[model samples]
Target chain A: MKRLSILMLLTLFIMVGAVGAQDAVTVTWWMEPSGSDDHVQELIIDVFNASHDNIQIDYQPQESINDQLRPALQAGVGPDIVWLAGNAAASQYVAGGFLLPLTGYADAYGWADKLLPWAYGAGIVAGELYSIPVTYESMVLFYNKTVFEENGWEVPRTADELWSLAQQTADMGLVPFPYGNATWQPSNEHLMGIYLNNYAGPDNVYAALIGEKAWTDSEFAEATDLLREHIADLGWFGGSLEDYYSLGGNDPTAMFASGEGTMMMSGTWMFRGLGPAFEETGMEWDWAPLPPFSEDADMQVGPYSYDLALGGNLGVNAATEHPEEVGIVLDFLLSDKARILELASTTGFGEWVIPLRYEIDDFPPGTDERVLRFHSDFAETTGAGRYGYTAWTFWPARANQQLWEAIELVWAGEMSVEEYLENHAAEWAQDAADGLVLSILPRE
Target chain B: MAFKIDSRVGVTSAYRWRQILSNYIFLAPVVALNLIVIVIPSLTSVYISMTKWSGLNQPEFVGLANFERLINDPIYWKSLSHNVIWTIFFLTIPVAMGLTGAFLLSGIKRFQMVYRVAFFIPYVIASVVNTELWRTLLHPRHGIGAWLAKQGIEGFDIRVFGSKHTALYGVAFVDSWHFWGFLVIVYLAAMYQVQPDLYEVAILEGASRFQRFRHVTVPGIRPTLVFTLLMIMIWSVPAFDYIYLLTDGGPAHASEVLGTYLYNMSFFRFEVGYAAAIGVTMALITAFIVAIFVILRRRGWEI
Candidate 1:
């Protein structure tokens, strides 16, 4: 009898082990290398794995995720989850039927209430949610505090003040806006967004995006003219088109840090490299929202709102065999506030796009105060509905590309501002008519 | 006796079949590899050129539309023109430099091997490293240009790769610098094979150095010269890495080459079909050049 009982127990144990083995599912994820910290993703994966037993997350870091993902997905063999740059990129995957609709996952995970309204809306295409944003960015005017104080240059708040300062700086044999577009042409879009939103105002820009207003409208043409005049007058980095094309990301930042330039109009992504760069020069830096393009009272959006962008938006593959497990992995990655705070602390600034419910105090101890303040200010201002469109995050892909190329032509004097605007309007209208535009929220 | 002869004939036939089979067995691997890597992909690319594919979804059939777009696209024409310019520059500059270097080196008796190795160093170095070296040297701010500017030299202060007027030439110059040395080694090998008697006869006939080089060396290396010219022409069609790394065909399509343009269209713009069409166009150009060479050869031209 005793021997029979022991045998029964052994059999039961074997059955349970087999069942547990069958329950285990490994989810594959391909992510681009995080610019801030390399090991933070590994650490996140480790924590998530430790917290769960039924699911194993396989983390792979790819240098060029889109380039690799395209062929793999085409072969009907891709990772369970892919980290995309933004909704603009995710929409392409969705259109190709490569990405699974996150609508069901969003509901199950309570993502709608968790994410910012605009961010949540941005990920939707034709009323279907497709991506969950993991990082956010915005272009702003970064000035050297030391340089400004030494030169008695007040930070510009209006278009007149900004241009006045630019002219004065040019007179002093210094660059006003140390812009560089050589390495990455798409960077031109950032400057365009700033000028368009501030000059033409967000409403006009939004209207133009949805095909309700023409880009050839006087406001857009004026914005282009303003940008062209600035380019001609200032001539970028070293005061020539050659310098503008030759200067890369680091060159202009280095110039600003060393007081060779007064200000740099760039995205918050620059923080990752700028911290180390500024360390050498002991240059203190601060960011301000871009100045209004005009002081006209009719331009309602200027002086209040600024361009906002999201990065590192991610989605699950429709072809993934383990959708449930992939969802669980994504939930863990997006919702683990403690791990997210830890990553933010290590990186010295938060590039992560967390739910608005998380406050600065929720961050890990030893997180830099300045970085926290920057995030907090942006969040508060954006939450208050004082935010505009960023081309990379919001514009349709073709339109966004056209914007960059057209701006280059205008700057090079190959195309007139009117012609550039007309071309943009035509392309945008076609895209909008084809139902290619992503969901966008109107400014309140 | 007749039956015995029939058996012997059967054995001889079997032996012949076995010999043929052994030859095929030896060739099997290489033939299979070529079919898999080259022939299969090339055929697929030709098919893909007729379809609209973003490389993510089902490729939709859109016969001739991509080609039509390519014809209408100004950027395509512009990039093709740049490739033509690139071919001309490589044909003239690198070929001249290589021939001159080979001729000068062939005449040298002391430290000949040292000179050969020294010239070949740049060719052996990775293109990325070579491009970076040139970028730094040509940089407007902290490079030789800046140093020269401090000495009151003005022209060097301007950016080479940045200017639309100069970007194509600047990139071609860098590529040529890295490539000309390879031509030097090839030409030198060909030059060494030429009999010394021909040169001696030319010298005896009171031929000047230039005359001897033009008359004897030129004729002797004609085959090599033609081969290198063909290679340069074909290679120039697919010239990508240097231009891609240096300027990325940017600052308003100033340095756009067909290779970089096709790459951008395929990857960045997601116009894979259009890019494949461009590829087909390039292949046609290569084939035409090859056909011309074949016809010339058939017509009894020495090359």
Candidate 2:
């Protein structure tokens, strides 16, 4: 009995040893969901592992991805690849010297011509490709079809028609427009996109941001004037400013879906969050270009591009033992552009046309139809001439926060538009005083 | 007798050595923990405050520049003022309310358990959940306060946190809800131990309830009140989670306290050095207030 017991113990130890000796390559990726779906990471990992022989992709979802990434990169323990929401922070990360320059690699892979020019240029900083643009985002008008159809009103093709329709909708006792001023992106960008394109004209707005003209100029004042009119004409947002954070992108879309408002201005990424409910509403809704301010003006719509840059990239730590392997894996991941788009669609991320190898004509199952419409719109618009480039996108992350906070202050009536402009100049002067300067020329 | 004395001395010396060794063994874990968690990080923060660290890369030493910037930063000054006001407001008002609540609860004989639980519920709830609940309740349009406004209650229709003038107060009122219960519990526990004989003796001498409270109950719980007040003063200075979850120090930094301002500096702006300076200043201010309370307590004053 003792000999048999010893034999059993020896066999168990050997089995454990054999299991521990299994060889696998572990690659860590940092990702924050740019859309509503939680299954994006899981689905991608499952498929990638199934297709590969000896590789495993580990995903980490972070709340403040930037904040955590900065510290981790500083500690020389950052991930192998990072999926980012192409935004202003991506450039800042590249400037911080934490991202691997990918210009040569992107060219070698023939990815330069695959992505849109705007999307590709958005990720470049100081003549280096720090990141690959994964997705494109834009703010657009979402209106209640049932309400408009019931009123026998055509979808407004001009700014005047929109306001006139709003008045008519208000007379019918429905909230004409619903948006919040709490968040800079949802509140300011949403309003600015429409106001800048339709009222002030996108060219003048872009020039002002790049310092070709001062923000206090007459054209800028006209923009603010237009904003003020929206406030005066439109009813109060359903919730208080304190609840604005929660009401930001998703809740407001939900409000529009539930018939709380006739129209809302929100980002395209919201399609996934509102998709299921929209399917239930059985309400026929269609996308339209933002109407022109005058009859002669072109239909203006602002493109919301998530500029994936090195500022948001995951850099393999130089300190890691398997640097070559990590690079190889990252290269493989970026090589498969079709898979990236598929992963994005599954993740409920906004439509992005990756300019890399393998283009799938047919979208995978679970891809929302609204997303397809946006993708086509992106192809038509190319986001040039109509939309003002994101000022936050080209600047450092710190500067962006300051700008947003200043915008919030102005919106809260703490400062006048004039004071806001003055503060903007002072803030820039302070940045100069602190030895930070504009690093890139503004897009023409 | 001399041999016996020698043997006793030998035994006592051996015992003394063992006792010292055992005491060190018991204290080793705690001392190591303090060194690893608190002392090392605090020292690092102080060191980092003297540098130009942006939560990334090597921190370059730029002595006193961060501190100078903090001194000139208007937002920092405003946040400091808010912190000070919050401390003073909590120390004076919440303590009194707590005392009043405790005194009232002491009179109830039946349903006392239910009352205690009711009063303690807010204290036990997570601060974030409580802040969210109060934010909803205090919302202008679709909240309880607004519902009251629809029923003809004046001043309740307006958003409690909408204006700069009332934003901080709205946050303060929400915070007061969670804090008052803790104060009540502490005051009650202290009041329960007050001598029954003193109250009876005061009553027999024809003292009214108010007089009895002023002389007996107040004197008996004075020490507990002072301790709680000092602790509350320290806590109010760094009170962050409630404000962060609710206001985000918005409407033009009207509701900003030092903690939120510091957080924005570091996490939002990536200005770690400036944030650390703010943190050090907060620590100093907390220490100074605590020292003042200690000094006043030593003077046996009832403030």
Question: Which CAPRI category fits model 2?
Answer: acceptable
Cα error, candidate 1, residue B270 (Å): 1.5
- How many residue pairs in model 1 have overlapping backbones? 0
Candidate 2, residue B133: the lDDT equals: 83
lDDT of 1 by residue, A332-413 (tens): 7677677776775555544664544567777777665666776788788887777778998898766777898768778888
Q: Once superposed on the true structure, which residue ranges of model 1 sit more than 4 Å away at CA?
A: A1-24, A353-356, B1-31
Clashing pairs in 2: A86-A306, A86-A307, A86-A308, A90-A311, A90-A312, A93-A311, A114-A355, A115-A355, A137-A304, A138-A304
Q: Ignoring the other chain, what TM-score does chain B have in each prediction?
A: 0.95, 0.92
Question: How do the residues A1-444 of candidate 2 rate in per-residue lDDT, one tens digit apiece?
Answer: 999999999999998766644555677777764553355455566667666555667777777775677778777788767654344455445546666676766676555666556556666666766666544566666678876787677877667777887777667666666665432332454454455445656566555545576657765566665664555324434333443432433446656676766776555655555666566776655556565563433323342322211213334443445545555565665566556776666546443334333323545666556666666554545435345444444444555566667665665666677876666666655554544433443454
Question: What is the lDDT, from 0 to 100, of the residue A259 in candidate 1?
Answer: 82
lDDT of 2 by residue, B34-126 (tens): 999988988898988999876654588999999998878788898988988888778877777888888888878998778788988998899
Consecutive 10-residue window with the lowest summed lDDT within model 1 chain A: A347-356
Error of 1 at A305 (Å): 1.4
